[model samples]
Target: MLSVSVWPCAQADSKAQRKGRYLPEYMAHPGKMLPAIAEHAITHYTQPGDLVVDPMAGIGTTLVEAVHADRMALGVEYEPRWADLARRNVEHATDRGAPGYAVVVQGDARDIVRLVGSDTVGKAALVLTSPPYEDSLHRHVRCGHGSSLTHRNPDESFIRFREILEGCYLLLKPGGHLAMTSRPKQCGGKFCDLPSRAWQSAIDAGFELLGRYVALLSEVRDDDLVNAADVPAHLPRHEEVHILTKPANSEVVAQRVTRIAA
Candidate 1:
């Protein structure tokens, strides 16, 4: 458990430069996780050779970071376009001599257990991912005092999101960790506390709440932090990272007891 609350993952570089490690087309994916965020979670939560999985892997950022850190990786993406891109990114990491191996599957994360197969069930050491902000792939508008996005029925979307979290729970080994990053957003003149919603969703999916951490996405200047968004109001300075753990199962506890007795 890291006592520090904020993770300073913001880099002193332009957005294009910061994304240089990924392919050009990957920029089109709106929900892509920051590389530093993925790297920090992987480094702190898992060891070399541990398996890391990302259920909603947009363009394989988590997978790439995990393999680069010498950990095996798995990703599941629903869209065929993004799934293909994820595979290409994994291939690119392999070509660059990343020490660990990775695989990308084209399937819905709500069915993660079946997508990754029974052999992979309960084998992952960490699950790092970000859920989509709303029902849409990208924000309808990037600027303005309030959101210009259309309000759709979020009930179905949230249901699917919870299903994905439940699947992630089943994919992890006993006592494995899950790190998810999300930010609050204004939708249709109302503030949506997405981080809190995600935290509740994890709890409902059987994960024990560990701690909430902040990952800065802005620059520090003159003892003040710059806002990363170009929006005129409700600007975002950081994303909330919620760390949680799957409770150890009876089988795992019995194994530990046996080892101690031996």
Candidate 2:
């Protein structure tokens, strides 16, 4: 088991960066749970020196956590402020007693394959990301002056979302693991349908469903927060974390064989 203690921070390296905590774009943020998530993946699917990638790298919480745990982390953020903030947080984390490698880029995750180099991105052993929802959840109120809602059409959300996932797919080494945090249940006046779409997207993007659980924050109560403003009475304010993996080893091998034969 590779614990966070193995990678103690080294203050000697001068390459520093961060994204300050000036913006609060999304309230349903997964800021602190990242360390546990990264630690979980490291214990189960990776080693002490593997790589972790987060496409939406919101506040850089995930990257900081990965670096503290002694794993290299790569992040892509469409928002410059967020990306810069993430870089700063990562740098400060390593500057502390946490040891590991971290890198953040400001760009669309759809271009990850090109930005990080095709072969390099496709060779990671684990990818952990908290992607944006399909709907324009934050259009009503823009916090921190963050630029999230791309002017794309309805399906464009899913298209780019899947593109980001598939980009991770190509970067994930065989047998590698992928864990994504998503809110699959949205408040739809009379009907709710967040999980089905999420499931469909995951399957279509070449990820094998592994496991999922409610992300119950031990310190905070989300039920009260999400249900604010007299929202749906029946809606349960809970987020489901989908644990998925790169297609199994055998499947990847068979595909390679078929391609070679062709």
Candidate 3:
């Protein structure tokens, strides 16, 4: 295993921007995650020895946990520097007998099938991710993060995020699962719903929702200042965890057609 590097980039500022967009690579610390991502994935989706992937591996938190839990881990990052640091961190974080892991070449998720080829690339098991929010503190979509798969105008993330989902849908083996976290834009109005656009994106990608959980920022971290701001914002706020699964062929058809045909 490669050793971790105590590099300056690994300790970069969270608010750093690239080309006017918030760089997610900068935001990838152990503290930036939603609570349910790790717990739900550990409980419901994966089994030991299975492969677990996080397309937006960030600081390698999910993959780190997956390795500790005995799942082979794979992560993809849009930023080359982050990809390097993540691999380094995961290697150092893993203990003896933890499942093996690898960080692949810096590539676009749009061609995920091409990068990893098959969903079962490393004994395919499950996927867990937290998509980037489209808007910012002022409530308008914040675009410009170079590492996001896509950065559509009038939208937050780039097109690569969509490709990641598409690739994930195609990559999971039959019975594999996916989990993600997201919040709606109308979030602070007391009437805004959990963003269903991501829900629709999952549905379109062919994963079925299993269950959901919500957690407050206080439950995960101390965000008193974020909430105290004059403008309502997502930083240091509550978030929803969405679980999805691709039903096994048996669940979908109730029987194996191949056996009947034979």
Each model's lDDT: 0.76, 0.59, 0.54
Q: RMSD in angstroms, candidate 3?
A: 10.1
**What is the lDDT, from 0 to 100, of the residue 153 in candidate 1?**
36
TM-score of 3: 0.66
The candidate that wins on TM-score is: 1
118-159, model 1: which lDDT tens digit per residue? 788779999998755653322323322212111223455566
The residue ranges of model 2 lying beyond 4 angstroms of the native Cα positions read: 1-35, 134-154, 185-192, 219-237, 250-262
Model 2 per-residue lDDT at 85: 74
Candidate 3 local lDDT, 214-259, one digit each (tens): 5343321252323323224544344566777766775552222232
* TM-scores for the candidates: 0.84, 0.69, 0.66
Clashing residue pairs found in predicted model 1 = none
**Any runs in candidate 1 off by more than 4 Å, and if so which?**
1-4, 13-19, 135-152, 221-223, 226-234, 249-262
- Pick the winner on TM-score between candidates 1 and 3: 1
Q: Clashes per prediction?
A: 0, 15, 8
- Roughly what TM-score does model 2 have, to 2 decimal places? 0.69
